[model samples]
Target: MNFKELRDLFIREGAEFYNQEEASALFYRTLDQLLGWSRTKAVTSLDKYIEASDLPKYLEVLEKLKSGQPIQYIFQETWFYGFPFKVNSGVLIPRPETEELVHWIIETLKGQNGGSLLDIGTGSGCIAVALKKSLDGFQVSALDVSVDALEVAQYNAAMNKVVVNFIEADILAYSGTESFDLIVSNPPYIKEDEKPKMHENVLAHEPHRALFVSSENPLIFYKAIADFALVHLNPQGLLFFEINEYLGKETVEMLELKGFKRVTLKSDMQGKDRMVSCSI
Candidate 1:
């Protein structure tokens, strides 16, 4: 079959599982990645023949998508902050809102550096590596409880040509004397019960350890990281968190009760409280 036919097939079949725009975007992006055919080229060369060898792989991926697998998992890579990250079932797919958090950190430190920064629960090393790439003068390190997740983070650091010290340790048990000028985390903040509100693809494909926290104590990671910051952060050091939207007020209260100063909660592009920053 020709390219147009394949595109039509995706629109028709994928609509059964996903929305029209989502299905089209996934199909075109997968095609571009697999065959180096841009959407414009696919459109202009409507009659371009599908390769005999490539069709099988495309069909298989489409089947997986129909089965509610995330496209990023099928591809095993995603772009964050204009850089590529290798990802799989072990890591949470990087979100655009987290990019905003990174941008805020970079903007906050635009003219200053030569200090250390730590990314707690740094899945895929996205924050740590991205910070290193943007702030070459700063030392960057990342820690995660899951060694498997750390492996993906380390690989992404290498792929992005940034050096980040990767540590395997639970945030609750971190005991290093090393201090940092900044500490940041996008830790698992989704409560266990919120799973029903999430898309089936996310629930099925993403690692639960990288996505959930207890409903009773939704700020579990935040509290641990904040406590760690109290001990390990240099004077005037800042702490940043990508937070749960529903618990923004509670998160801010926890940080303040922990004696953190200048506590601030910021919303994402969608205007939901999604990030917090403070200093001690």
Candidate 2:
């Protein structure tokens, strides 16, 4: 079928899962990947027929979309902080709120000459790589329990031409001699019971270990990371976390109770308390 027909098919079929605008955007994105055509080019070539060999690929993508698989997973890559990173079922897809957390960190440390920073549970290495790319002076390290996720993170670090120390260790049991001037984590904060509230794409495709905590101890990772930071953070070092919007008060209180000073909870663009910063 022609490009216009394919585009129409995407809009109509994708409507079951996404809004019209989102479906259209997805169409253009898939076209760009398959044909290397810009939006303008795709629009201009609407009447051009898709090659028979490429038709199956397009149909496959449509089927995956219908099945509620995230487009990012279908492509096995996504953009974050203006850089492209490889993603898969091994890691959680980087979200926009996490970008704001990165921005907050950069803004908080803009004029500093250099400092050490660690990203706990650095899925896909998006946070660590983005920080190292933006703040050239800072030494960045990332830790994750999943070796598969670290592999992807390592590839992304090299692909982005940024050096990040990748550590395959669980934060809950990690003991490190090195201290950092800053530590940040967007750890798993969603409780197990919250799974039902999440979209099918996330629940079915993303790594469960990277997205959930036991409902009995929803603050499990936060407590462990906070205690780790208390020991490994340099004097006056900063700690930041992208927290669950529903657990902002509890998280902030946990930090305060742990003896962290100047704990500040900040909301994302959506006005939900999604981040917190504190100093030792």
Question: What's the lDDT for residue 235 in model 1?
Answer: 97
TM-score of candidate 2 to 2 decimals = 0.97
Give the lDDT of residue 80 in candidate 1. Answer: 92
Model 2 misplacement above 4 A? none
Q: Compute each candidate's TM-score over C-alphas.
A: 0.97, 0.97
Model 2: lDDT to the true structure = 0.94
- Residue 89 in candidate 2 has what lDDT? 86
* Candidate 2 local lDDT, 1-280, one digit each (tens): 9999998999999887788898889999998888899999999999999889879999999999988888899999899999999999899999999999999999999899899999999989999999999995899999999999999999999999988988989899999888999999999999989888888777888999898999899999999999999999999999999999999999999999999999999999999999999999
Question: Candidate 1's C-alpha lDDT?
Answer: 0.90
lDDT of 1 by residue, 1-280 (tens): 8877877777778876688788888888887888798888767887888789779988888888888888888889899999999999999999999999999999999889488999999988889988998885899989999988999998998888888998899988878989999999999999999999998889888899899988998888898899899999999999999999999999999999999999999999999999999999
lDDT of 2 at 241: 97
As a whole number from 0 to 100, the lDDT of residue 57 in candidate 1 is 86
